[model samples]
Target: MSEGSAVHQWLCWGALYLLAARVALSSETRRPCPQSCHCNSVLQEVNCSDGQLTTVPNSLPQNTKLLNLTHNKMKTLVHWQFQSLPQLLDLDLSDNIMALIEVEAFLGLERLITLRLARNHLKIIPVGVFAGLPELKLLDISSNEILVFLDFTFRDLTALQFFKAADNDLVFISHQAFTGLTSLQELHLDGCNLTAVPTEALTQLSGLRSLHFHQLGLATLQNYSFRQLEHLKELVITSWRWLETLSGNSLFGLNLTSLTIRHCNLRAVPYIPLHHLVYLVYLDLSFNPITDIHRNLLGELLRLQELHLVGGSLLRIEIGAFKGLAHFKLLNVSRNLLTTLEVGAFHSVDTLKTLGLDNNPLACDCRLLWAVPRRLYLDFRGNPPTCTTSDQLQGRYFLDFTESELPGLLTCRQPRILNRRPREVRVDQGHTVGVYCVAEGDPLPSVTWISPQLKPLSSIGRIRALSNGSLEVRYAQPQDSGAYLCVASNAAGNDSLPVSLHVRAFPLSSEKHFRLKGWFAFPSASPGLSGKQNIPFDVKTLMVAATIGFLSFFSSVSVCFIFMFFWSKSRGQIKHTATIAYVPRSAVSSSNGGKGNYMETSRFTMKLI
Candidate 1:
């Protein structure tokens, strides 16, 4: 993957080189070559990149100002090619099959600003290769197969702003290679296969602002490689896999806004906070094979907004791991095999808005939710909610469940209030007696009832629940002999037990005694065929029964009146004199958590005394 990405990077750089060459060559004038070479005088510039020319084109018309011949079949720079063109301002001969250059190759042109000689098949460049281009601002001679270079290769450039000499087989870059440039802004010398760069190789640019020295294929970097860059805004330095020690001295005075280190094989990152870079926003330390990242190692970056921690092979996430950060917006710890997110791992991220958990084979078991407890309201835009049963999260993208979807798996239990429901049997005329114990459920269960006398009753009375979980006959007649049933239900199903009742024939003993007394004691009365004595009334039994029933009726009337008066006094409360024990706190416990916390409005308590 790394090699393929590098090849793609080279392709992009090749396109950029073509564009720069085309834009800079627009201000130049071109004419016909002296030797039967073709010329396009329509456009002012002459571009001959990747051609089969042998020597420099000493064409006619000295008014030519630009000449680009990158990647051509040329071997040496002839003296006659330099003697002809004195008005040239830009010259490019990059990626050519050139082997050597004569001392008198570039004798005259002193007004050049941009020069490119990259990707050539040269072993060495002579001392005075660019000694005449005094006004050069940008120079790129990268990707050459040069093993060693001369000292005075670039001695006259005083207005240089950017320089790149990367991907060369350069084993050494002399200290006097950049002696005259004082205004360098961005410099890159990466992938040069260098072992060491002398401190004086880059110490001359007094106003250098940005430096890059990545992929040098070195096992170590000289500690003084960045000794002179005091105004740098970005820095990236990476070595081979064996480079384990990144000393604190290597980052002595730089307070760069962006810093990246790859393939360092780091074991730890010590407390080295860059002081003056208040704008430092990004830090990436990838591909290191690190085992741990200590808490708050980058704690001093008050404005660091994003952190990417990929390919580190991290194994543990400790508590306070992200404490004291004020502006870290997005964090990606993806592509790792972390088995657990330890306790308090993100306990102090007050401002973090996004967290990535992709490419990790995290367990989606019941216990994993105990670690995070609940999902926060933060933006979980791209994070996938994992499922236990399938690899494809079952097409549930960012889906979340409320209390209904999770019961014991979410630390929730159904209310036991429904368990103690009294049996209710509703009796209608044509409908069979149905006794169902309807209970609110975390999961609802089916219920049923039973009755006998398969024929339907025409005059069914209003059903009332029996206190003993059974139904009783409010009024019974000879035809009312039957069985009634009450059922209790559960999640599996419901079952009921039958209750039997028998109606026996009642005797008429009172009528027989009254008839005997009337026949024996009294003859036919003259007034109205009365042949019996007058029967005496049972006044004692009747008076006692009447007195008891009257007292009960009076007591019920007084209670009803009192309740009605108080019900009108209350605003939103309905008072009832319950026959069960009522400690108000226990009643309120059903509303709060299991903690039994209660809250009362500061209104008058119209509670029943």
Candidate 2:
């Protein structure tokens, strides 16, 4: 027989064996049911929930495997209350308003596997209350008035695997609170009043695999926070308002495969700290104010498969941000401030099976044309990515445009000069002068200055065009006094603006102004020898000239500073040093992945206590 067939037959045989055992146990006898309670002999279960009983029923069925006393008025469990029911496997005493339990309350129920004491007024648990429940695997004492957990609080639950103590006023935990829980795997401590991660107490769970924390007052995750949790596989944190920092060494010793940090006050990604998580496969950092994903920040995690950054202020994802992630399959960046997705942002789009770009105000242009052929993988089943501010494709969806129609639907906007208003500059001979011209466009058009002589100005001599597209003239002379043009051009088109410059000669003391004006105004003209006019020096003229000169100097200095600022910033940009993995095209489509809505909120929720 084939291996698959053999396994299927084995499973069928196991099911039949379990059914036969249950039937034989049910045929033995029918036990008596206590008053105000329901009993099922076939299932060996007793349910006394919502019965308003004041105490445990002493007449419970002896062979019962499940006992539910939830929603009762029992104030306490007396010593040896369940001694007669040795076969009980599940015991629920939740919402019972039970405030106390004797040290020997669960004396003889040695086979119990699940115990719940949630939503009660219990303030403490005696040391020996759980001394005999050796087979217990799950315990819940959440939503209570418990202030602290004493030493060896759960010393007898050696087989425990899951423990929930959420929504409690837990202020302190003894170092030995979980002394005997050797088999524990998952522990939830959300909504507690603790100041930080209880590292000292968590080291006791050597076999722990998953941990969760939320709504704590921790401001930072210090270095080596979980250094000793060697076997941890997953870690989740949420709703921590004061949490803003994750130290570089915080996750040094962990080999986690999944990590989630949402609804926190983080302004940027903790790249240094995440570098050691080389085995990570899933990362979710939603609802934070992370403005940029600089290159090389996340490339170290080569095993990463999925990344989600929704509802954030993400402005840019630099080139090579996902360079080393060979197995990456999905990327969700919805509801962000991303204007365009650069083509070089990923190593190769071929490996991606699902892409989420919904709810973002995308600028439809050639930058997004690369994604047209991959529309089948864009995850457009729900709300596809739409253009909100593009000149031509606004209110249109990316999936609606085919590869051939991209040239028409996604277009480049022509460059347009911003400062088109003509302004005339008047400076004394040998003084400096600067004319400013700004423009806006797609593809970022380049600027060129045209001299009055109709010659293109270069950065060679006393005249130059600042990197910010402004023209400057040093040691101004009569030849430089004329209309200067500024032209901005890109692949789409070009725009030009004309500005006039006047270099006046110093007037003789005896020369008089033909047209005098107010102190704040410039004189219209002056008596001259032919077309060349001269003006006498005065406080008003000097002030005007000084003001004009200062403006030119300030403009040149400001534009030059802006150019250098951006130049330095670009030079300091980081690049990923990790080597990228290249898989065959056949492997790309064969890889497994999960599809999900980009704009959807987290689905993780706690059980109501």
Candidate 3:
């Protein structure tokens, strides 16, 4: 009980009391989980899914990293509802009936990386609703009734990388709506009511790599619609029924590697500015109304690896159609109206690996023989093409024919006029006139033109015979007004058509004449033409035709003889008729401990064990 001992004891007691107070304060600061929620402190997660709660739960764990309030009946996100959870990394309020989000809803969640408000009833997002989530990388406000995106709506979400606002009633988006999303890589705006490309709005996403705008109400894409998206690599635009024309340069400056535009009403493939898409690798233009695969249509796609033209109205594939696709791998031209395939149509695609030509009306003639060598790489399993031209080969699979049968079957077809020439053509003096003629034969008919004076006319000057057998006459005069003859001859036969040209004097007006010249300067003609008098048949030509006919007939007879011989030999080799006999198994088993039974038939013997 000395003075020093009393002082020491008092100091020790004071220290112990302060330590106890600190422990109590720490315990008071720790928050308890709400009654409807499930908290896992070890994993720092709080889940209140399907709780049917009308309001956001309070007293959430402060250190929670993930908070899921999905399938709740919460109507709104009030200001600072989750302010206490500053360490939150993910917040999912999806499948809720939330219709409104206050400006300061996420006021203090600066460390949040993901926020999902999908499947909610939100009609509009306030400008500062996501103001405090600076580190957010993904935001999904999809499946809502959002009608418009105002300017700077996401101005505070600079770090956002993936954003999905699909399945919304969005009809308009301000030009600066995505001004702050510099780091955005993927944006999905599918199933929106957008009628046109949001070019101005997309200009803000300079670093975006993938964009999805499918199932929209867009009608057309004007030039340079996506010119500002230089870094974009993948673009998907499918199920646009109203979309018809894609203007040249619409995708001019993009470096897209994969582009999908299917199930649209486009009559032809868009003339994409391919010079900018040097890195393009995959392209899909399926389920469109494109009628023809013209030469050089995809010439500039040198790096293209796959092309899809399935379910289209493609009637013809001209020679050199796939001209510049050096690295082309797969070509899908199935389910089209392709009746003839020209030789060397895919000559430029030396690297082609797979070709799909099923579900097409293919004329199994010599023209299709070009694919015989590459048949190993072709896929015809989905409705194999049947012969449509030759009567003997009709309804038979093209792949069933032997190499020897092809030459005779193909050469037997005679030359015929596929496109008839107009009887006459009238044009004003100083204007242009054109005549075309198209023919089809086994050897591909050779076209010749005869002048009015019964002299042969070769392609020269303004009058030239195009490769497609169309004749063009520029600056028509009185002398040019005469009958022109187009003769197409092959080894099988010859066809001649005549077209009369009449030129009328132009009016005495310099302005009108000049306008006519400008307008008719490049008058194009379809493949056809005509004249009087067939060319004199030479003995050499006749002999060659006769030889071809004889050889074809001889080959066909030889094949028939060989088939008959094999059939007769097969009949003679079959000596016995097949018959089945049965006996009781118990009787046979009694001799072998029920291990087996035996039966004898006329053609064979069998034993059951």
Q: How well does each candidate superpose onto the true structure, as a TM-score?
A: 0.54, 0.67, 0.65
Q: What TM-score does candidate 1 get on C-alpha atoms?
A: 0.54
Write one digit per residue (lDDT tens) for candidate 3, span 18-40. 99999998789878888999999
List ranges where model 3 is wrong by over 4 Å.
1-45, 272-276, 377-478, 481-609
Residue-by-residue lDDT tens digits, candidate 1, 1-609 = 699999999999999999999877854654445443434454445676655777776554575567778767887876535666676677788868777877646667766677777777778877766566667788887887887656766665678889987787878878777677677888887877676655677777667787877676555554556776778778776655666665556666666778877667666543453433456787777777766667755566777787666767876565556565667776666666664453345534556666665555554433244324335554544674444333433333334644455443423123222445333333322233323244433223223334464432222454344433434444334344456554544322344445454544243355333333544565545323223355533556657989999999999999999987887777566554444444466456665755645654332333464
| Residue 189 error, candidate 2, Å | 0.5
Local accuracy of candidate 2 as per-residue lDDT tens digits, 1-609: 999999999999999999999999876754579888999988998999999999998888789999999999999888888999999999999998888999978989899999999999988898999878989999999889888889998898899999999888888888899898899999989889987688878889989999999788889998877867899999999888888999889888899999999999899988998998999999999988889888977878989998888898998888788888878888888889988786678877788877778888788887777788878755653777899887677898877786687777777779999956778889987789888888999867779999888999997788888888888999876667898899998656799998888988655555544433343354335333224333335667777999999999999999998987787678766443444445555444444342532232223333321
Candidate 2 lDDT for residue 248: 81
- What's the CA RMSD of model 3 in angstroms? 31.0
Q: Using TM-score as the measure, what is the rank order of every candidate, best first?
A: 2, 3, 1
The alpha-carbon deviation from the true structure for residue 603 of candidate 2, after best TM-score superposition, in angstroms, is 99
Candidate 2 Cα misplacement greater than 4 A, ranges: 1-30, 413-439, 443-609
Worst 10 residues of 3 by lDDT: 526-535
Identify the candidate with maximal lDDT.
2
